[model samples]
Target: MGIEIEQKILGHARDAHPHECCGLLLGRGGRIEQIRPAANVHREPATHFEIDPQALLDAHRAARDGGPQVLGYYHSHPTTLPEPSATDRARAAGDGSIWAIVGEGRVTWWRDEKDGFAPLPYALRDG
Candidate 1:
């Protein structure tokens, strides 16, 4: 992932303010190349996020059409800490996908493994 992507995620998180924002990460081999913003269709957008199902489907379809792979997801914590919340833990699928949580202008990366969410180290590259 690039620092530029982190900056974009932080900016989206800030723009979302009290509401959580969600998006899909398009990438390859664990490296994120792009962030596609999606609608947070959760009933309580302030505290939770559910990426719009249609958007998710479209992304998958695009990937089938030779687009970037759907590598992971990103979300924001408007006023809370950057770490994953209890709600996040409960909802995680444990599929070993990357999850980025943005808060306070910073982003924390995690891997949703079978056991739990584990911290992931990543380099911020310049484009």
Candidate 2:
């Protein structure tokens, strides 16, 4: 992740405040080129998030058209640590997508694996 993207995630979390913010991680290889903020359409926005299906579909379509790859997803925890919560673990598809969880003034990365989420260390690359 780039420092700018990290800042944006934190900012999104702050802006969402009581509700969780969700979005897409867009890029290729080891670089994240953009963050697309998506509407959290979950019924209980305060505790969970469901990225608008349209946003996901659009991202895939764009990727097929030579846009950035759909690297993974991101969401905020609001009141918890930046680690994956039980709810997160349960919802993960284990498709090896990267997940960035923002909370408590920090951000943590994880790789959703078949067993569970594994901590993923990332360096902030200069943009």
Q: Which candidate leads in lDDT? A: 2
TM-score of each: 0.97, 0.97
Alpha-carbon RMSD, each predicted model: 0.8, 0.7
- Model 2 ranges off by over 4 Å: none
Give lDDT per model, in order. Answer: 0.91, 0.93
Q: How many steric clashes between backbone atoms does each model show?
A: 0, 0
RMSD of 1: 0.8
Q: How well does model 2 score by local distance difference test?
A: 0.93
lDDT of 1 at 45: 96
Local lDDT at 23 for model 1: 97
Kindly give the stretch of ten consecutive residues in candidate 1 with the minimal lDDT sum: 9-18
1-127 per-residue lDDT for model 1 (tens digits): 8888988888888888789999998998778999999999999999899999999999999999999999899999988888989999999999999999988778999999999899999899997
